[model samples]
Target: MLPTFAADDYIELAADLPATLQAAIERDLGIDPAQYLANAEAARAASDVATALRAQGVDILGTSIDGQDVTYNVADEADAALAEAAGAEVTVGPIELLDSGREVQPAQDHKGGYGYAYQVAEADETGSFPLSRCSVGFSGFDADGNDRYLTAGHCGVDEETGEQFTYPVHHIELSEPIWATEDWANEFPGPELGEFVPGSMHFGEQHDGGLVDITNPDWTGVPQVAGWAGGSGAPDENSVTIRGPIDAVTGAQACKSGATSGWTCGEILVPAQSTPVGAQDVTGFIFNACLLGGDSGGSVVVGNYALGVNSGSTHDGRTECDSWVPATGPDDTTGDFSIGYSLSTGEYNALTLLGSEWELSVAINTPQVTSPEDGGQTGPTPTFTGTVEAARSTHRVEVTVDGEQSYEGTIADDGTFSVAATEALAPGEHTYEVVATYGNHSRSEVASGTFTSTEVQAEALTVESPTNGQTTDNPRPSFTGTGQPGATVTLAVGDEVLGEATVAEDGTWTIAPSADLPVGERFDATVTQAFEGDSQVVTVSDLGITAAPVTITAPEDGSTVAGDVVFSGTAFAGATIGLAIEGVVTESSERVQTAADEWEGELVVGEDGSWTFTPAEELRDGEYTLTATATLDGGDPELTSSEASVSFTVGAEGDDDGGELPDTGSSNVWMIVVGVGLLVAGGVAIAIRARRGGSTA
Candidate 1:
């Protein structure tokens, strides 16, 4: 078992703790103390090397450590050898490092407006009617202590002129009437209305960000970012604070606060990525968090550290917003991906674009949990312990079991606290939450863990092979589990008996169903153990049986043909046929109704399980891969029979005689015309002779 800590706590403790203290902390937390210390040291050493390389102008993406080995995530694989020679292990990342050009679009309608995080502003074109809504990135001051704020460069640019500056920005915070038009010259100093000016914009080939000058004295900027209190909880007073920028690594949890989605947390998919958006290229990190239109310029943070700025989502294909849409049914498959520009790059660009006069920084760091690990499993009476960085402050830690407060406690002087559940937990998996609050109601992000409570006196039953929720192509799955020694075990599906086995001397049992289970049916596998007059039952839910395999026969692979081509295949009877010709799916006819069970359309499958397909139109002269897929009715649509594909080529066109047609031109036409003329002259003479003879008679 490994000790668990909050992500931020792990990073801090790993980098700053003494070796002896690290070991003692790990041991107390039920983790490998020695290995943890070694890994920490190695990680710190690797970070130093990375920092040096970065200072020397190397484009290192990020770095992570596992045990005593460090893996450097770099864009270029050629740098692997050089990084390894620098005294630590290294690996190349799959991300490409490219620049993203200017991003622009028309403004959108919003429900309401606010000052802090979700404040909305519009950028209007100089002589046109185009405008766009954008959010404020963060607040910072120039070297001269002048107030300024940051936003996306695309937000300030005029789409028609392709220019950044000269565009008028309008906001309601300091402006009177809040919804005034962009007639800046006449609207200036008019009562309660005011217009903000654009100072500088950078649509660098590598980044799409900019800084806007907030000249109004009535408007103020805060050092804190907008987010949920704990990374995953609801928005509150103790949401998040801005610390300095921190290097982002893969597998770390990151959150995004935007005007659209508010705050959502997801793991960092790629620490460094360079991808193309339309004509422009963007270089940054890819996260699994959801982003939407008008979310640009939002902050991407990890705990107290500002990591990146929201750029755009990959789901947007330039036509419409492709934000995450939840799956509607069991077969509905949809996904959305988001991208952000690293704060490290953003900071550099900020200084270069706005001149080295501006200084950027964040507010205070929220308290963090450092023990009992999130999402860990333990006994029913598991001990809950954690620590906060705030010293000499009264800390109250609330422990909630399945969303209800069960226990509360106070922290000790050493920044540590523990609590034991007073009530007994039932035999099953239960979720527990630990929320630590310190100093004037300031609360740390909530920490959560899950634990399963098993009765000591009851026989421990655990499903071993063909684990719970396992999907298999084989209808008859092998089931194995451990139970009380000499106990009789019977496995069943609903009311149907599968098989039975007796626990051996070692307390293990195995069984297999005598008959194949129906495909696509979700059923629970109940394991019953009877001892004396008592019985125990454990179930594995959602075991899936997949479709059978299939094969294509005629129009053999690697053969050339033309005209009407025939495609045949063999599949199980009553199975649905999916045919694709040159990557385009063809409509399928109903299941064969005849005794032989033959199905027909562009493709035909016989009841004997043999199938054939003939294209309705003449086959084009080109190489193609004809694919046939079989699907069973009750199973998942994604889980179907093995696809059968045949590659064949269509040759040149043919004639009526099955060969090239003979050429006939002007000569044949002239001969037919002359023969008709001669026949007509002879027929006229014969008619004249016959008329004369009849007059003489």
Candidate 2:
């Protein structure tokens, strides 16, 4: 009966391995023991990733685990986009089979050989003995520290019936070894080492295993797998170590070394199915490897971890096991059909079938980072969290966001951990990495992800007054707006800051320009609100805020009048209203106008911004144009209105205007003489009118 273990045991597997096993681990996997263990934990974590991908509708062909990476194989190249989005490398096609780089396996002879019967002699070179050709899988140790052997159950039991049979284990010492650290193998099997344990042999649809009590300690430790040389009968090459549980996922490679077909390799196939084995029909996973008789019960491994035992292959044991016929479908069982049984499914575990005490050693598993999932979004102050197995309290965490160290500390051993960011993170996509560096009873582990950092937003900023396309005469106009409290708003003319203010507690802001805004023409005003290192800006253009529009607004524009002509119109209440009669009618008209443009007296604009002028003198019959304009009182005289004209004619072209002009066809010299004659009189009349002037408001 295969037993069960806690969830923790399924993730990380750690051990203080024998020095020989350590050496073998580095020799084959080319990595230290700690990394190998951490990688196993990382590989286990990928099951959840596959689940996530499936949830996204991506059909995974297979999966291969190596070191810290898990490569997924998919049929369609388009699936790559979906796989990578979930943070997994994708291979578009079947598994890639790597050459074993070993020697041709030993010759196979069918002995009705459900297994082989190798020759053996005494340890002192005495006599001959009996040995099964069925291959040995992984070695292990019982809780009592006693060495044990693991192999296919069918090797020591009846596949059709359930009856068990005892098989003697053999061993020998080599005088001249071939590429080996220690010189001992079952080549020319020596003496009997041990027999298969009673009740340990069992074969069914789900499980197949038999345990052996290896009394002789000559073999590699429980953490190591045996190796074989090219065309050699003795099992000499012993450098491959058992790191952790094999990745049972498809697209992973299965390698083994057995009594016959010594060292053969194959890659996992897609869509696992069951095949008939004697009376029961149960298979683990499928692969495209070539296997023959005497190879059954051999070790099935992926990477450096122990998987299970070789169950069956389509190639009969009678012929040379050289040709490989890749299976086209699950029903295509004629050739290249091979199968393996996994040690543990979610419900079944054959590794501990013998007893809970008997076990294989493995490396430590890595902790998984669960925070900031790839392509996720979070606030500036994001917290880091993750799931871990074993030694929770001793695991120290160090975190970095976008290459900047964001956190570093220890976590509780509650199978999970959480670390808050010490400082605010910047905006945008930030790649974060988490390292479980210093942990008691555990090796270092690395986890990483990316998330978009977004800032907390306040209300939108707005300007209430000085809106787009507004016209005003007030130079230092008070600007107002509604925005986030404490935000600063500044109005600028070109590059010059006109006014600035901070929004009050009521979310309202007002600004009085430090200097008057430009006048007399349309320009643009930029209003910006800045808060928390970010700013929002808006521009208001074509603001009609210039010199006051002081246009002549009377005399019935284009009207005709006779001698007693009075030119009057609106202007700045405090400014002067002056009329200039020019053109052909100038010489015959009287000077009934204010000398404000000439700066004779200040014409202060009234509070109502309006003023009118009443002339005193009458005009001679002639064609004349009247233009009235206003000038600022206490400012630059050039700041006068460039306003439109209010034109009128005295004895000018009109509908029977004022009878006929006195000088309608007169010579210019005579008209000038007449105007000069009236100049002194007009001056005297203006002086009298100024003295008698009334309020122009």
Candidate 3:
């Protein structure tokens, strides 16, 4: 979702958050920070339209926010047209003040949008102290360089006992093993991370916050925040670097990671000074996200900057964050909002409350170039890759080639970036430099490198695989060799084109002939790989392929015939033919049937490459299968074909014409037998006709 062209949130969002943080934002919220803000803006505009129409007494059914489209559902198309004309897409929806939003009816779980909400708060501040817990927000340095963390001030106060209650801040390595389960805060008491500052807390009508003085030696002065997305894996929850306070913007996305609810993100419905029912006239802003009872004191952030501390939520009855869901947008009037105490301008600004001399941490490191060595040769459009400070949010990278053409890309969460030139650089010695911009608009030192561009100067093609004189059994053999990537490689035999392949990214090429080459025949082929035009060709000579598989060519498989039962096929000259028979049976009597036992033998192939063989005995009038396998006289395993088989029946499908009859020489015998059978059939027919009193015409 894109914000309105006039909205400043988009520009502010792009500038406020670093690329790594932006990536994390999208990962946790399931909404681009810009889109989340845009949705809010769009929803706000739509709400105004709805209110105006309602004032005119227009009946609005409901409202929805999808991307930048804010719709108002009307009872009829007449209202739709009117709403559309008023600048909001017609379906219907709203915002305003709250009377104890925390005590309002539970928020509708099935709200509009699919944005993710992190349920990361730990103990419910509403829960009785000693048994309840609150979440830590951000870390900072005190006037004496002492490490300090901040949370909601009301979280440390025990309203029940009113003794200024302080609870142990258990320290656990933020990971799935220790922090994934909801009850792990109580189950795994790793260690004491820090201590709540004595008398350094406040919960007034204008502000609410507290500071936790860091006692752990290793964690002092660290500028990191706990980032979780309500999952069983991924320490993504431990990410997010807080670079001090930044004023919050209405309609922008805000997130908080807590032990009670992992990580929930939503849009700010109001920037500040909103009246709500709970804690009458509480000093806070309203944001639409899933904040449970224990979320109080959890850090609320907009981009990479610290915004506020979670105070409480309207949906305090919810137990768990079911999944990442979208915000209801800023127009939501249904008391489904959470409160956060301002850290930038409120009376409880962390800086003033902690120590006037306290300063937030900011880190920036120079990026390192790891590709296109100091003075190496590379293709014109070489890809540049490098690394930046791993934990830093290096968002943008720029690479200039020869101080001319430049390429840019977003840095990844892992603090690495890659940019490939869109066009070829001028051929010759060129100096390239890379620069990265990360957190708090910190720029990395220009990482420079020197390289010579080959332009289109491709290396001559080489046919190394054939190796001058090579032979194989592959009828269509493939050729392999190295060449410059991005070049087209061609394989040809004389003027006849075989096939072509492009040189792969690994500087290699492979091609094979489209059709099988003649067996036992040797020839030379030319291969050329180049850009723009053909380059010098490398010839692969004395390359040959082996013979074709033996093929059966007699009696056409599946044909029925009564004859001498001969099998014929073609094979390599001087090869031996191993013949095997199956499914053949002969019946000596009608009462008994006998199955033919294994019938197999070997035959010598003739010099002409064609062979014919006849079984020593006649086959019965039944189906049979004959298999002929050819074995090379002394050929290599890579130079021979597989066996061939055919099936035929010794009956009506064929006669002596296709196969010779065992003892009979001509068709005269068959004619005589037919003439005798016909005479006997006529006499029997006349006798039957006389008995039935019918004519025998």
Candidate 4:
């Protein structure tokens, strides 16, 4: 059972280990034991699900059990159609586990091999005859520093076209092959048979299958081919094979191959069936796997072992396999012939074909770098140069940095280029490609290099977002700067630190505010290190504030009172004033006096306290302050009156009204009540007494 059947197990697997290791490891090993257990459980469930799907004849790419990814070869719709058309039954197998294992080379006994078919220039051609889909395959570099590969003998025959047509086949499962004049078939030996690569081979057939090199290429991963005959087409030469290890090979077991009838696995009736081709008399062993017209030259393997290469099969009447030859046809009722040549024979043939004339060796060497490769340099920009060697120095050469055109110098009389780079490059890592060219022949090599400079100082910075003291409705403003392109820019607001962002090639950046900010109507926008200069601070004024001059019209200066005192100021519209007493503040009050000025409201004075009128509101006062502030709708602010404080006592009134006197408690309440009540009551009493005295006299 796989570990990651359920979503929970899948997440646990990721949490348990690094992402890269997860693919190579099935067992979870980490601090969280539940994660591993959950992965295992999930894998079981997923395996079950995948089994069900395969039973339904659905093809699955990859699945997970416990905590690892799983792969299932469920019969897809196409497979079902093919099976129904052939009237054959199908079934799925158990989940196979896989992980990282030691790398090893393929044994000579492996019954599969690969070779190259070179593309030669056709006679009637202009500039250069293209290979179209054809290219060369290399054997890669062996431990001995020699690189050998294979190509068609005809490809090297033409003097002009051979060198020009030497190009690597992309996405092909083989080593990069360079063109060699020696005949790989005879005079110039080709790659050894049974070699493996993590790519697929195309033989201009209906199917395309890529084989994975488990031992070589360091056990490179292979992209899943839906089934045999579903991947790349197998060649007619029977040169390539996909083999599972011996333990994986099973007799009478169903196997797969890249051929016409993909995924067709027949019971292995006999290990080796000898048969002969008509007129050719080439007798070979026949396997249980049925073969069709396009199944020629395909590798038939069990698990990871290569058993044999498909040769050909007798055609059944009406596109149906004969039942007589169960090993050769879809039906055992009809007569069919399923035959293939053993790899042993192919290997023997290869040894005889790869004579001593063409030396076959492999090695891994660093490709040449055309760009600069130096360390610890400053001031002057560096230039890079190099050359590559081939058995034949007459081939044309093209050098490039990062795949782009850097230098296209040809191989000189000495078979190498001694030229300068086209541009003055900076310090960093660069990928270089060396392409050999001769008429129509071309092969490319890739290498990398790094440059460094310690003398260059970072340039100054400039603000791009908000200008000096620019207020924005958006609390989070994007801080932008102009400096070294692609350089990391550090930003901050007030005392809080903001994160850094890398500038693009163009000097421009955008960032959100760090966190919640103060609610003040105005703030100081301090942009520092914006330029070569030091730092600068600019204060953003209020968005809705103005300033104007105001005069205190009521409550004369230095006036002492125990009751409410009306202190008014003159200023523009929206002007306001507040009373400040001993650092205590009262609510601001406003009253528009004119278009140019406004009169502020009154303030209350208390006993033994200083009093002054401000914008608005009454307040208790040991001392009072008058502050006149004017706000003219989106205009500059004006402080008309400075802070004014005056002290007064409530006892001077001597009202004898007891504690009921309003001025006795908080000055704010007492001022309004006592100040207004005293005047009203005294006036009413005087009127009543005057009427009574007038009547009696």
Candidate 4: lDDT of 163? 30
TM-score for each prediction? Answer: 0.37, 0.38, 0.38, 0.24
Between candidates 3 and 4, the lDDT winner: 3
Tens-place lDDT per residue, model 2, 430-496, is 8987766432222345676788988957557787888887877798888888888877799898999
lDDT by residue (tens digit), candidate 3, 332-404:
4454677787775334355556546345554444668777787998777777887876322326788988788
Q: Which stretches of candidate 1 lie over 4 Å from their true place?
A: 1-49, 53-70, 74-87, 92-131, 165-199, 228-236, 315-335, 346-357, 364-697
The window of 10 residues in a row where model 4 has the poorest summed lDDT is 684-693
Ranking by lDDT: 3, 2, 1, 4
**CA error at residue 443 for candidate 3, angstroms:** 13
CA lDDT of each candidate? 0.51, 0.54, 0.56, 0.34
Give the root-mean-square deviation of each candidate in angstroms: 29.4, 21.5, 22.9, 24.1
Q: How much does candidate 2 score in TM-score?
A: 0.38
At residue 677, candidate 2 shows an lDDT of 16
